[model samples]
Target: MAAEANADAVLAELEALSARLTEVEAYLHIEEARGRVTELEEASAAPGFWDDAEAARAYMAELAQVKGDVGLVDRAHERLSDARAALELADEMGQDGAEFIAEAAAAAEELTRAIDEMELSSWFTGEFDHGSAILSIKPGQGGLEAQDWTFMLFKMYMKYFARRGWKVTVNDCPAAEVIGIDRATITVEGKDAFGMLRAEAGVHRLVRISPTDAKKRRQTTFAGVEVIPVLPDDIEIEVAPDDIRVDVYHASGPGGQGVNTTDSAVRVTHIPTGIVVTCQNERSQIQNKAACMQILKARLYELELEKRAETLDEIRGPKTEIGFGNQIRSYVLYPYQMVKDLRSGVETSNVDSVLEDGDLDPFIIGYHRWATEQAE
Candidate 1:
């Protein structure tokens, strides 16, 4: 590859990668990030910094992410400069410099990939987009099939979350009386978890031969996927404690001795907003209530954001819902086998790969790419 390597083309690619890296760095405000890092470091070192656990965590996470971005840009710049110098050196030398040219070509490819990832990260500029997320899945229409479909959707997201290396906490997932689950809510903790998952915040439809049907008839089911960024305790919410209600209930599911015996599950309801959150995964009512509060706060924060901005409609559409004809994506298995994202115009015949193994990058990346164009 070295003997036939076009050094000029390789150099051009490296230059473009370098320019893109600079653009990402600028968009991320690396200089401002460095200043913010210094401020955060000083504050963290002061007395009682860790007194508020959630706020300290948020502050530390931001500092770490900013530092990482700055480091990534710094290394990418060095790689670009080195690759350019290698090409120049190869040009000055004779055929003996072919190896250097080949090395620079490889570096160019690597830098391209790294810069592309950085560019994607730069798109998550929202307040909580870079943070973790609260995700909920509820079966819509189709009765028993809908319940089963809810579990399928939950499994698909579990696979997707595993692929993304996000830590997921199943705050609640109660099985239906006969088939799948009544509802499933999870907390996804990872960098850009909310930003990426928000792509799936809408209705998903699945059509297939119903396993619950004795006649093997085809059935269509719908499930709603809600994604909201995890609200940090530092952010003041619009609700008051007086306007909220808390209830405890015995946890329901296939469980152990202490699990189903007592009222360990907690439900939180915001009266004014009519937002309800439930958590039953923990055996302790207090822990479950905490989880419910976390999810509730996220929902409340999302509601507040809705009133102030229009950009959320890009991800969630205009009053999009979980019902017939409102699906953002469709998975067909009976007449034809395919998984399609209506918003991104991305589809594939590999239904098993999507529903089973969780190959979701195409749809997620495609949605962002499409959204970027619509914005432009």
Candidate 2:
């Protein structure tokens, strides 16, 4: 009876904590500032709204008030998450229900102290992070080896996502002749998928022996990874049919072997932006067309988001630091094995493990902390 009562108490506490956590997550995910901004907008729609000095003052004042409320909610959410994490850890480790309560109490207290030491960092908390992501990997310099390295990277990420139990779907795989990949895009679907992959948006550099060379010399290669948020259907994007040029082609394998007898591949090019998206993964031409259009919309949406940034300096620009010229992270297999994230300056000398299995939590947390510092 005592044990049952203890279990009930713990569950009750957890239920309350979960409710608070959900509230915080909602506030963090959506800009609550939108409400106040909307009010200001509605006020402007009123007759002589802009010209009325008293009305303008009142609207601006209300906007500021809502902004403050939103910030408070965001902070509360971060604290709630930390508390819940501590409680979860304790619950997993405790022997019995009563012990779980005692352990959780201590853990929660410790978390309170830890969180008090610093401000919360959570820049990756956008509506996009809640959805899946599209990761595009393309090889940079170096010869046939570079292409081979890109293929290796493609496999590495696939293995990583597989280990995490995340669903991965390859949309396109443009293969190289001898031994490499020209370009490839993969969709990783899971909870907080974009947040997990946000750190991988930069360049990746690899240094190793060239198997193709008669002389096994050390070679350096680069690959660029572009991570884009997969927008949902609710997020409306207005694109006119006349603005796009759609092409149909028979899909083929690496060596031009016709995989589909019919023209099942669809390529959609945004005429205005010159953004081209191709999809041949689906067996049906109609499905491929839909897939291509989905990617096209995502890319265009990302472009617009970037454009809205305050200045050109805020943008990642043309070059991705992920590769030969620049690198946000590196995986070394020869001479020494190590994995490092340049932005966070975090590293682990377990290249084999990281490549074989994707354990990116450390890197992601580091990047999140770093992003928070930048904002401060």
Compared with the true structure, all predictions reach lDDT values of 0.84, 0.69
Model 2 error, position 63 (Å) = 28
TM-score of 1: 0.78
Look at candidate 1 and give me any clashing residue pairs: none
Whole-structure CA lDDT of model 1 = 0.84
Encode model 1's per-residue lDDT on 1-376: one tens digit a residue.
4554688788778877877887888888988988998998999999999999888998898789878988888888888988988988888886777888888988888787677667778787677778888888898888988888988888999999998899999998888888888989999999888888878988999999989889999999999988888886568665577988999988876222235778899989899988889899888999998888878877777676688884567334566657888999999998989899998999999999999998897898778778788888
Model 2, span 231-303: residue lDDT tens: 8766878889999988888776544456778888888999999998887888988888788887888888878
- Which 10 consecutive residues of model 2 have the lowest summed lDDT? 113-122
The parts of candidate 2 lying over 4 Å away from their true place are 1-123, 252-259, 310-318, 321-323
Give every collision pair in model 2: 203-321, 203-322, 203-323, 204-322, 321-326
Compute each candidate's TM-score over C-alphas: 0.78, 0.65
Question: What lDDT does candidate 2 reach at residue 253?
Answer: 55
TM-score of 2: 0.65
Model 2, position 155: C-alpha lDDT score: 81
